[model samples]
Target chain A: MTAPDPRLSINQATIKYAPLAEALHLTAGAGITSIGLWRDSVEAASLPEAARLLAGSGLRFSSLCRGGFFTVPEGPARRVAMDDNRRAIEETAQLAAAGAPGSAAVLVMVAGGIPQGSRDLVGARSMVEDALAELAPEAQAAGVRLALEPLHPMYASDRAVISTLGQALDLAAPFAPAVVGVVVDTFHVWWDPELTKQIARAGQEDRIASYQVCDWQTPLPADVLLARHYPGDGVIDFAAITADVQEAGYRGDIEVEIFNQEIWDTPPGTAIARTIEGFGSAVSPHLLQAGARR
Target chain B: MTAPDPRLSINQATIKYAPLAEALHLTAGAGITSIGLWRDSVEAASLPEAARLLAGSGLRFSSLCRGGFFTVPEGPARRVAMDDNRRAIEETAQLAAAGAPGSAAVLVMVAGGIPQGSRDLVGARSMVEDALAELAPEAQAAGVRLALEPLHPMYASDRAVISTLGQALDLAAPFAPAVVGVVVDTFHVWWDPELTKQIARAGQEDRIASYQVCDWQTPLPADVLLARHYPGDGVIDFAAITADVQEAGYRGDIEVEIFNQEIWDTPPGTAIARTIEGFGSAVSPHLLQAGARR
Candidate 1:
């Protein structure tokens, strides 16, 4: 049997109830060397305390949860969103510096959904483009990379208008790879017909900023945002997708980012155990082993 | 101001609870010359009775609701599904013969969801292709057209594996346009980034068997299938899509095929009136009028 992939990371969202310092300690005790952080969790724990805990524990922050909602249609609201994103960049830079050198502390960007009382998807997407032009320079100077996440089309109305990886890549095309890349979360993109080609394109462009894993289950909970399942619990072909990501040269942390209420209700240890187990069962076998494809 | 497009048709599903004979009288009474039928309602109303009513009511049977659930993995169940579809074709042909002589009595095909205990979307799609190949000859012989309908990606796992107009067009390519075509329902496809291009391709190929319209509303009802709103009630850009569909050369019935429970709860006359009003308000403006574009 192949060994557990050292690249495995547990996004804090997979066990949202676990306090950050406690989560860090628990993750380290459980022998996990990497983590993806959510801004609210970090702020709740206090950024300095979160930074110090990560620094002392040698944990890599795979990415910081979200910095884009640029669909405010300009004016004070848009400025506030841009300012909030700038602060997220500052936080990402600080965390990256605090972590072991060479770790990528990427800030995820969930391009906001359509503006209220509006149905103009094209216009909303353009807002994201304009915001990126304004924020890319700040991201580059701060040494923080922004990973534009293409949420599933179901969220097209309320979460993110960038609903396909190809579209995200097109938006990221005008910016440098170091400053603008994309997050490939399985839950949001597994059904995409263009997934394989776009993933390959992301690799070709060196813009695969983060690789997130979660399975998709049906009878999607009414609260769709929290409906993500742990890796092997749903129908996503993880081994196949993971193999493709590996072939695409994404040699980075594979973060499990589930948001299921049931999973959240579980004791943190049990939830973490289930996530690691599911990750091992669904993903570890696909990692390159002895130069032989599974 | 332009006259309401005479091509506008109301799918029986738009007023789901209305009795068949009453619905025909109501629709014809409202000056609608065409109506799409759902098989269950026909079967509930009895096929012979339905045929007799349409024969006397002077209402064109625009299309027949759904005859494909071909995603059952090969076995006895698959054979049963094919046989059921064959019966649906017979019914479609019978109803067509009973209506206006030139009405293209089309059967909408919703390729069923993933087979139980199966996560093989490709395999399911292949089953649909094979089923189509098996059934196309029968469809042509019966003088009934099979319209492959691509449901939204959210329904990919549970309702239909065919989730985009492009995939539906690809599937129909192997068969004659008269034997196999595609349904362009705005609710299922409005979110597709490639919608305009695919709609154009469908027109170029002469395979647009039906054009279905219903607005897409979010905070989707728990029963997602019933979440579709009447036109002008949600985020869809009806004028743009209707114009594109028209440009694509679809001069057939524009069917309002909603499935909302609230609408169903409304009185049949009230529901039909609302549907006509929404159709006129949302679609009538973009329609071609008397040899000139609106």
Candidate 2:
């Protein structure tokens, strides 16, 4: 059997407690080949310095954390949001230009939620489509594939109106390959019934921008803002989902993006080590050993 | 516009704090047209006494609480579990037979969860199918239309492996309409991406057995056993969901099924009254308006 690819990518949020340079160095030292950095982290350390650190560490950019909150409702505020997204696209392009070769890495898109005082989720979804249409040309020029992340339904009201992998696909369908795609986060969509079908659809459409892993806790807390489950801590069927993604022909970085207070409080290195271990124990066994191969 | 139907149905668990006969009397006095009694409640009250209370109160039977634990793995224990489900089906038949003409109701089925020490969710699902096949014929003879309740995926481990309406439909698809159908409960499936599609499918397939309502909390607790949101308390796009159900031709009692510690602590009368109010403000506006226009 061929050796398993050791391209473990660390999401900046996993070590959000650490400074960007420190986190990058930590990830590199751990021998992880790739890293997914947030724009905020890049902003905190000057982009040039952050780029220098990546260059020194020899870490390939898996993806730029995000660049799409285009679901703002029509009005002055919407224009402002669009302007902000354009700036984000420019920054993503700059990062892409500075990073390793190939098509510019994915610019993860998180469709923003319903505007204040609006109950129209469908309307918000349309707003995202319109914004993506507006931003498509610029994104294409930058050579960055926009990865639309469908947040969990719990965040549908205030985070991302695009709340399903299928819904994200519908939004991205109208755009060209480089202009629009999707980010599949396990934390958000581990419970979806059409998960396998949607992932297959994503692969067929060539819209597999990123694949993330996390768990879904039961007895979810009353507050939605703080609700998130660590990768192996909750009850998501990760093994089956990963297998489906692979079957769909997606050979991208299986990014581990966890949003947990408990994990976040720990030291960045410790968290990364724990996450790496969790990924191996929870996912690798299933992905690596299928049928009677074991 | 037509007046909305007000046939209140008391799920035995609603007044679990009270004795079964007392609950029946209280619900009857509240002018409810129907009542749902759990097997445990009936057993605790003595089946004959429970039967007498139902007869005396002139309450209609909306449904027998449940009958399905086929996911228990193969063994002596599995046989015992199946036997228990069969007995539950027999009791439901007895309840239906004892009811007045046009008053007999369906038997709600909570498909069992993954068997102990088993991680094979799909295998557990097959067990449910086998159990349903065995029980369907008996249920048909008893005049009980088995209403398979698709529980939340969070309960896939220990409560019910049938976690989506679509999955439930697939399970019920092979059975005769009278032998098997579906109960769409908002609490369990509010987060489903294909909810509208599945509800439409259920309607098209003529498999809708009951319509139930509840809300989903955000920070889902870590514990699986004690997490539920009351109607109108959480951020589910309920109006849109029920509208789809209505368009799909599901016309039934929009039962209020809340499993919350706060609500449970309140007096049954207060809880029922609150449920009625919440149901009206949160759900009825959408459902009743649709009914009115019809």
Candidate 3:
């Protein structure tokens, strides 16, 4: 068998139960070279300390957990959200400055959910677009790329209304290269019939900022917000998708982000180790094989 | 508020734990004029006895609970599965014979899951098509319309690989009028971005056999075979979709098909009553308003 791809990264959320320092050490020890940091963990550790820990662990930063909750209509709530996103960009820049040269990670964006009592999905999407336009210039000046993460349609109501890669790309289409792009999480998008087509479009436009992997389980709860499976444990055809991503010319970090009660309950070290192994066995085979053929 | 639509029907699978006869009785008692039946329950009671019960109740049979599992590869397995489907079609004909004249309920078709250990979704879909070709002539002769139910992508592995109304319509595209059509279940298809387009297409082709609704819960499970919510209980934009369906000229029965464990554990009578109430309050308003404006 061919050697596994070395660019594989583990998102801190995959081992969310662990402390940042512990998660960093565990991820690096698992042979993963990069890590995506969540804001909550960074806030808890303080950005400087989190940066110091990463520096000590010799882990590359893939992308920051999130920056955009841009769907709060035009009001104090919207202004407050924009202000917070700016802080997020600043924090991301700080992390980048503290890290090695050329190791800057994108600031992942989760365009906010529908405003309370709002049923207009189209309106909510427009709000996200407006927010992106407002924030793009600042993000560009900070030397940080904004990676819009398209959540699953199940989340369109209460989470990010930008629920498809195509939709995200459409919003990002007119933006400058440094201003906006997209983050593809397997858990959020594996079921889409247009997945391959959209990913190719993202690549053609040079809009792929990140790629994530997870699984969709069978017997999902009627409330989909609570349901998510670990990579390789659910029904997603990850191999097929990774092949498509590569074919689309998206050479980026493959980050694992699973939201599971079982993984959360486990110790951080054990979870990270298991995630790495699952990634190697289930995900790497396809990428490695594809690379060999090429 | 306007009066509830008398044409709406409730599929007994919506309250899966309810006994078949009781679900029918409760639906009728709630002023619902129609009901959909599951074949397994009918088989348990035997078709003659089930027909007798329905005839006694004076309720319109909206559709039979499915006939196609045509994806098992050729062999005794394939032959046996097709024979079973043929029997289901005959059972549907038997029910139609016992019901009111010109009241032939459609026989719903759930294209089978992937054959054991197989990963080719395209191949499985083709199997469904081939099976439909073989079964259509017999079903047509028996005066039964096969309503192909496009299950969600979550079921693509072990259930119906036909995961979208568009895909189902595409499969049924070449067939003669009313020989093959689609069952539009909101629970299975609410997440589709192209749902509105496909619904209009189904109406254009005059191929909508049935319409069903349920909610999608958050935190979806690893197994989605069992995950579903009651109407108005989750985040799907039901009012928008119902209006679209109405605009498309689909004057079919709106069947509620919630597959929730909570509803199942409740008494059948209570579940059916609550479903009727929810449907009236949550779905009827937009539809009634649309009708008035038209």
Q: Can you tell me which runs of candidate 1 are displaced by over 4 Å?
A: A1-4, A290-294, B1-5
Worst 10 residues of 3 chain A by lDDT: A285-294
Lowest summed-lDDT stretch of 10 residues in model 2 chain A? A285-294
* Tens digits of per-residue lDDT for model 3, A60-123: 7888988987888788988899999998998888776665444545899998776776656667
What would the TM-scores of all predictions be?
0.95, 0.88, 0.88
Worst 10 residues of 1 chain B by lDDT: B1-10
Every candidate's DockQ is 0.58, 0.25, 0.27
List the candidate 2 regions with Cα displacement exceeding 4 Å: A1-5, A69-71, A101-104, A113-119, A215-239, A281-294, B1-5, B99-104, B217-234, B237-239, B285-294
Candidate number with greatest lDDT: 1
**Better model by DockQ, 1 or 2?**
1
List the candidate numbers ranked by lDDT, top first.
1, 3, 2
Worst 10 residues of 1 chain A by lDDT: A1-10
Kindly list the per-residue Cα lDDT of model 2 for residues B1-294, writing each as its tens digit: 222236446576766687877777777666666777888888887777777777777777677887877777678987887788777777777776565554545888888766665556677788888888888887887777889998875566568878789889998989987779999888777656578899999989988878877776544555535455556777666789878888778766566666666667889877666666666677777774435544
Residue B106 shift from truth in candidate 3, angstroms: 1.8
